[model samples]
Target chain A: MTPVLIVENLIKTYPAFRLGPVSFKVEAGSIMGFIGRNGAGKTTTLKSILNIAHPDSGSIRYFGQELPGNERAIKQRVGFAGGAVDYYPRKKIADMIAVTRSFYDNWDDEAYRKYMDIFSIDPQKSPRELSEGMKVKLNLVIALSHKAELLILDEPTSGLDPISREELLEIFTALKERGVAILFSTHITSDLDKCADHITYIKKGEIVASDTMESFITGHSIRGEGRNLEEIMLHYEKEDYREKFAE
Target chain B: MKNLLNKELRLSSHLLSYLFLFFSIMALIPGYPILVSAFFVCFGLFQTFQNGRETNDILYSALLPIDKKDVVKARYIFVCLIQIIAFILMAVLTALRMTFFANATPYANNAMMNSNPVFLAWTLLIFALFNTLFVGLFYKTAYKFGKPFIAFIVASMLTICVAEVSHHLPGLEFLNTSDRLPLQFMLMFFALVIFVFATIISCRIAQRNFDLLDL
Candidate 1:
C-alpha cells in the first residue's frame, strides 16, 4: 500500500538553528508518534511538510504527490492542528467554523456537529472564552470534520488533562481504524506509550530513532524487559549529549 | 480566493467601520481636503501594518488550503476596498459642500475645488503611491512594520510638499485657474495612468514576496 506521507532529506535553516536532512514515512492506517523535546525541530518539520515553512532542500510527498506543487490538493486531504487554536480571537466559534468550512469542498456538517456535541463546544463562545484544552478540541473538531485522510498535530496533548488526553487517544485509534493516518508531535511520552504504533524520535534537529514502537522499546530494553517510551527517549537524549560534549 | 478575501474583510471589518466613521466626521471640517486625504492614506497604511502584526491571523491563514499568492491577492483587495469606500465618502461630502454650503464662510473661498478634477486625480495618485510603497515594503519583509510605516509617511509628506511648492510657482499658477481646464484634465489623465501602473506593480511585488515568505 502507498504510504500516506513520505518526507526525505528535509532541511530548513534559521539564523540560530538548522533542521535536518531528515527522512521518515507514515504508512496508511497507522499512528506515527513524532516525539521530540522542545525546540527539537518537530514543529519546523511539520510546517515544512505543509509548506508553512518553506524547506531549504527536501522532497515531501503527501498521498504520493510532491508538496507546494500539489500543496492545495494535498492540504485538502491533510488536516493540521497546531498546539492551540490561533484563529481570530474576537470572532465567534460559529463564525470561525463558517469561514474555515467555506475553504474545503469536502466539509461535512454532520461530522462537525458530531464533534461539537462530543467536545461540548458552544458555537457562540469567542476563542478567548475557551480554555486551552477547549481550544485544542476546537482545532480537532475543525480538522476531523473536513474528512481529512491525514492528520498532523503539534503538541496536541500538551495542555490537556489526563482524561481529555485519554479521550483524544481513543479518537486517534478510531481514526486509524477508519484507515486515516496520523503524525502528531508531542513531548508527552506516556501518550505514545499507550497508543503509538510507530515512533520517530528527533533530538536537536536530527532523527535519533524511527521504527515500530515495539521494536524501539525492545531494542532499548533493560535485560529481557522492554523499557517505556520515556526511558528510551531519555537514554538516547543523554547519549547524544555525551557524544556531542565528548567531541 | 473568494473565501480568503471574505476572511480578510471579516477580520478587518471592525477597523474599517471605525475608519469610515472617522472619515465622515473629518469630511465635515471644510477646508482640509489635503489633511483628509493624508489621514485616509495613513489610516490605510496603519490598518495593513496592524493586521500584519497579528501573528495569529498569519498562522491561521497559513493553515488554509490556499496558495501564498492568493493570500497576498486577498489582502490587496481588502486595501483597495477600503480606499474605494474612503474616496466615495469624500466625494459625496465634497458634493454636499458644493451644493448646500456654497455661500458659507468655509465653503465660499475653497481654492481646492477651483480645480476639482485635478485635486481628485492628485488624491488618487497619492493613494496609489502610498499603496505601492507600503504594500511593496511590507510584503518584502512580511513581518517588520515600524520601518515601512515610517518610510511611507515620509514619502507621502514629501509628495505633498512638492505639490504645494509647485502650486505656488508662477509657471504653475495656471493649474489652479478655471481658464486652464484643459491642462487640469490632461494632468488628471496622466495621474490616473501613473495610479494604475503603481497599483499593478505593487500587487506584482506583493505576490512575488509573499510566495517566498516562510509564514
Candidate 2:
C-alpha cells in the first residue's frame, strides 16, 4: 500500500536558517517519532507538510496525491496539533468544538465525547482554565474526533509530567493499533523508546537518519545493540561536538 | 466557505465588535463629525483582528480543513458583514433624521457633517479605506498588526478630514444638504461602488500575502 504521507525535496529558507531538501515517508498504521533538538527545523518540516508554512520548493503528497491541489481534501484525512489548545482562550471547549466541527464532514461527535471522557475534560471550561497537559489532551481530542487517518503532532508530549507523557504514548500506541498513522516531533527520545516504531532523526535542518527504531538504536549503539535512545542520541551528539572541536 | 465563515463568527469574533455596532448611533447626534461613527465601527472590527493576533487565530484556522485563501476570504467576509450591518443602522438613523427630525433646530443649525446620503457615502468610504489599508497591511506579516492598524488609523483619519472639509468647499455645499436627493443618491452609488471595489482588491492582496506567509 502507498504510504500515508510522502515529502520530497522540501525546501524552506529564512535569512539565517534553512530546512531542506528534506524527504521522508510515514507509513499507514505506524508511529514515526521525529527527533530533533530545538530550532532544528522539526516544526518547520511539520508546518511545511501541513502547508501552514509555505515551502520554497518541494512536493508534499498525502496518499499519493499532491497536497497543493488537494489541500482541503487531504487535510480532511490529516489531523495536526501543534502543542496545546490555546487559541480562543476565552471560549468554552464545547464552543470551540462547535466551530471546529463545522469544518470536517467526517467529524465524529461520539469519538469527541469518548476522548473528552478519557482525558477528563470539562467541555464547559475555557482553555485558560486547563492545565498544559489538559490543553494538549483537548487538542488531541479535537484532532482525533474528525476521524483523521494521519496525525501530525508537534511536541504533543512536551510540558507533561512523566505519567501524562506515558499516557500520551499509550494513546499513540492505541491509535496505531487502530490503523491511525502518527508523526510526532519531540526531543524526548525516551518517549520514543517506549512507543515509536520508526524514527526520523533531524539535526541542523536535515534528516540525519530515518529507519525502524530498533535498527536505528542497534546501528548507533556502542556495542551494536541494546543501547537506549537517549544514550545513542547523546553519543552521536557528543561525537559531533568532538568532531567540531577537532576542526 | 460557509463552514469557514461559521468558524469566523463563532471563534474569531469578539464581543467588543458587536458592542461597537452601537457606535453607528452617533450618526444621529447633531453638530458632530457623523463620520466618526463609521470610524468607531471600523475600530470595533479592528478589535476582532487584534484579538485574533493575540490568540493565534490564524494558526488555529490554518489547522482547520480549509485553504489558506479561504481563511483570508472568511475574515474579509466577516469584516464586510459587520460594515454592512453598521451601514444599515446608519442609513436608518439618517432616514429618521431626514424625516421625523428634519426641521429640528439643532440639525438645521448644525455646522458639522449632518446626517445625509453624502454622510452615509463618506461612511462607506471610511470602511473601504480601513479594510483596504488595514487588511492588506496586516497580511504582509499575518502576525504583527500594529503597523497595519496604524496605517489604517492614518488613512481613515485623512478620509474623515477630507470628508468633513468637502461640504465647506464653495460649490460642494450640496454634500451637506439633505434636500438634494438626486445628487446625494448618486454620491452614495459611487461610494458603494468604491467601497465594494476597494474591499475586493484588499481581499485579493491579503490572500496573496497570506499565501506567502510562513505562519
Candidate 3:
C-alpha cells in the first residue's frame, strides 16, 4: 500500500537538544506507533511533520507531496492532536468548535455532534473546566470531525483512564478499517500492542528500530518466548544505555 | 485569511469590549480629547501584545492549515481595525465636545483644550510612533509580549511629555493658533503617511520573523 506520510532525514535543533536525521513512514491504512522514552524527540519529530516547528534540513512528504510547499493542501487532509488541549480557556467548548469548524470546508457537523455525545462533552462548559481525559476527547472530536485521512497524535492517551484508553484504541481500529492512516507518539506500549500494525522506536533522537509489530516482539523475545511490547522496548532501552556507557 | 481574522476577533472580543467601555467613559471627562487619544493608542498596543502572549493561541493556530505568514498578517490587520475604530470614536467625541461644550467649559481661554486639526495631527503622530515601536520590537523578539508593551508605554509617555513641553516653545506656538489651520492639515497628512508606512513595515517584519519561528 502507498504510504500516507513520509519523513526523511528530519533534523531540528534547540539550545540544549537536537532531533534528527530520522526517517519513518506510515502506510495508508495501518497504525504506526511511534514509541520513545521521555525527551527522546518524539514530540519534536511530530511537530516537524506538521510544520509547527521548522526543520533544520529534511524532507517531509504527505500523500506524495513535499511539506511547507504543500502545507495547505497536506494539512487539509491531515488532523493533528497534541498532548495537551490548551485551547482558549475562557471560551466555551461550543465557541471553540465554532471557530475551529469555520477553518475547514469539509468539517462534518454530524460527526462532531456524534463524538461530542459519545464523550459526553458539554458544549457550554469552558475548556478550563474539562477533566484531562475530557480534554483529550475534545481534541479527538475536533480531529475526527474534519474528515482527516491521516491522524497524527502526540501522547494522546497519556491522561486517559484505562477504560477511556481502551475505547480510544477501539476508535483507532475503526478509523483504520476506514483506511485512515494513524501515526501517534506515545510512551504507552500496551496501547500500541493492541492497535498498532507497525512500530517505530526512537532512542535519544535516533530511530533504533522500525518494523512490523509482531517481528519486533519476536526479535526482542528471549528463549523462544513471546514478549510484550513494553518488555521489547525495555530491552532496546537497556541496549542503548549499555552502548552509551561502553563508549 | 478570513478564518484567521475571525479567530483573532473572537479571541480578543473581551478586550475590545473593555476598550469600548473605557473609551466611552473617558469621553465624558472635560477637556479629555488628548487623554482619550493616548488611552486609545496605548490600549491597542497593550491588547494586541496580550493576545500574542497567549500560548494556547499559538499552539491552536499552529494546528490549523493556514500559513504562519497569514497568522502575522491577520494580527496586524486586527490591530489596525481596532485602532481605526478607536480613532473614529475619539474623533466623534472631540467634535461633540467642541460643538456643545467648548465655550461653556471652565478652560474656555485654553486653546489647547479646543478640539482642532492640530490636536488630531498630534494624536496621529503619537499613535503612529507607538505602533511603529511596539510592532517592530514585538516581531524582532520572536513574538515576546511583555517587553514590547512596557517599552511602548515608556516611549509614549516620553513622547507626550516632549509634546507638552514643546507647546510652550516659540517656534511650536502656532500649533495652538487657529490661523495655522492649513499647516495642521499638512502635518496630519504627513503623520498619516508615517503611520501607513510603519504599519506595512511592521507586518513585513512580523511575517519574516514568524516564518523562522519554531512554534
lDDT of each: 0.77, 0.88, 0.76
Regions of candidate 1 where Cα sits further than 4 Å from its true position: A222-226, A239-247, B12-14, B21-28, B41-45, B96-105, B108-115, B177-179
Query: Mind giving the per-residue lDDT tens digits that candidate 3 earns over A1-247?
Result: 6688989999888889888788989998899999998899999899888887888999999898888688877877898776675678778889888889988878999999998998899999987898776777788788889989999989989978898888888988998998989998999998998999999989889887788888877776754434987776676565566788899
Best by DockQ: 2
lDDT of 3 at B196: 87
Q: Quick one: RMSD of model 3?
A: 3.2
Q: Clashing pairs in model 3?
A: none
Q: Which candidate wins on TM-score? A: 2
lDDT, candidate 1, residue B46?
A: 67
Candidate 2 residue pairs in backbone clash = none
lDDT of 1 by residue, B1-215 (tens): 78998887666344643454355446556545454464464565466457646637777777788887887778777777776666666667655654676567764565543324465566677678667877778888678767776787787777766665566688886654445767876887888788778888899988888788876
- TM-score order of candidates, top first: 2, 3, 1
lDDT of 2 by residue, A1-247 (tens): 9999998999999899989888889999999999988889999999899888888999999999999889889988888776654888888889889888888889999999999999999999999998777787787898799889999989988888988888888988999999999998999988888888999988889888889987888787757533877776676554566788899
Fraction of the real A/B interface contacts present in each candidate? 0.66, 0.85, 0.64
- Compared with the true structure, the alpha-carbon lDDT of candidate 3 equals 0.76
lDDT of 2 at A58: 90
